[model samples]
Target: MDLNVTLVLIGVDIPRSGLLRSGYPDPRTGQWVFSPAKTAKSFNPSAVTQTERRFDLVDLAPFDYDSAEGMTAFVQHLAGIEGRLRLLRARPGMLTEGEMPEYLFRRTHGIVGLLKRLIEDGCTEAMESGAEELTPELLSTIQINLGNLDDRDPTAGEIPEVPHNVPVPARKARKKDRNSVFDDRGGSVAGG
Candidate 1:
């Protein structure tokens, strides 16, 4: 019996100190070179030897937290405001309207995960308090867990100014561009 197997590993902010144990400055090129016993004692050398290929994927573009339209769209999507069923029953002039988006940006420091939690908690609080809409006073009562990633101190910067009367552009809607080679005789898609 014969078998072909491939394994791929993906990680973020992986620490390289353990892999490159010790290095001395090269006398010829004045560059640091790993010593013969570079691998840490805990790391199995066989694993490194077995790794046929290593690829570092390019980082994706960061979210435009500064864009009022983008942030509003994100909040609306999370709250199901644009959908048939609403996750948060925000008052008419709140959330996607007025200064709520700016206020939320300040509170969450523009972090999407944190913003989601904040809105979810605010919704729960509103429901419990019998409030019709989310208010600054009501949301202030809800505590957000920042964890280790963000500082408890308020983010230092002026909130991005939102343009008035400017319509938020709709997301581009287009059919996926497919290769003509995949089309069958009946003009239907065939398995690649």
Candidate 2:
């Protein structure tokens, strides 16, 4: 048998629209009919309405995963953030502006502008250096590291030779002009 003392100690917060066991008499039968007892109407509405609050925490749920793609994307995002932060927190000496022959006074103006331009120049230089280092071998190595350079794939085989004698489809070449409008059927659309 269930004990009543244990159940009584736990005060259950049941949402009651009216008093429990409350009833009304049937009009025709004169029998007592019961319904869920709703609490007496209050000055307040049923639901509490308030302004939406902002969640301060960063949502990293999408980046948190056991999958290789998710991990790679997360790592790439971190790397990008690191790069940007490094640039943002860079010292004036790190940029080429320090090498400039101009001497600054104690109350020099436009120093912030000079620093901004120097940072831009440094970013351009870094981009140029990265572009110069890009090669097919580096790309192949990256692909290999990512487990994408599979030799077993048919399309990944040696490049096929192109045939000199091939029939080209006879179709009118459409001109891509800013003022021109073309529809899906290759017909000129009537509009500005």
Best by lDDT: 1
- Clash pairs for candidate 2: 17-37, 17-38, 17-39, 18-37, 18-38, 18-39
Candidate 2 lDDT over residue span 1-192, tens digit each: 434442222111111222224345566765545543345566653222211111111111224335667545544543443345343334433211221212111111213323233334444454555642212222222211112334433343222221222222233568786843554666676894
lDDT (CA) for every model shown?
A: 0.52, 0.32
How many residue pairs clash in all the candidates, one count each?
Answer: 0, 6
Instruction: Give the per-residue lDDT digits (tens) of candidate 1, residues 1-192.
Output: 324555454332222324333445566765545434436565685454332213322222223566777765656654454243243564444665555666666676555556667777877777887884576667677777545644323332112222223223333578998889865567656684
Poorly placed runs, candidate 2 (over 4 Å)? 1-42, 52-62, 87-192
TM per prediction = 0.41, 0.19
lDDT at 48 for candidate 2? 27
* RMSD per model, one decimal: 18.3, 28.2
Q: Which stretches of candidate 1 lie over 4 Å from their true place?
A: 1-62, 67-94, 146-192
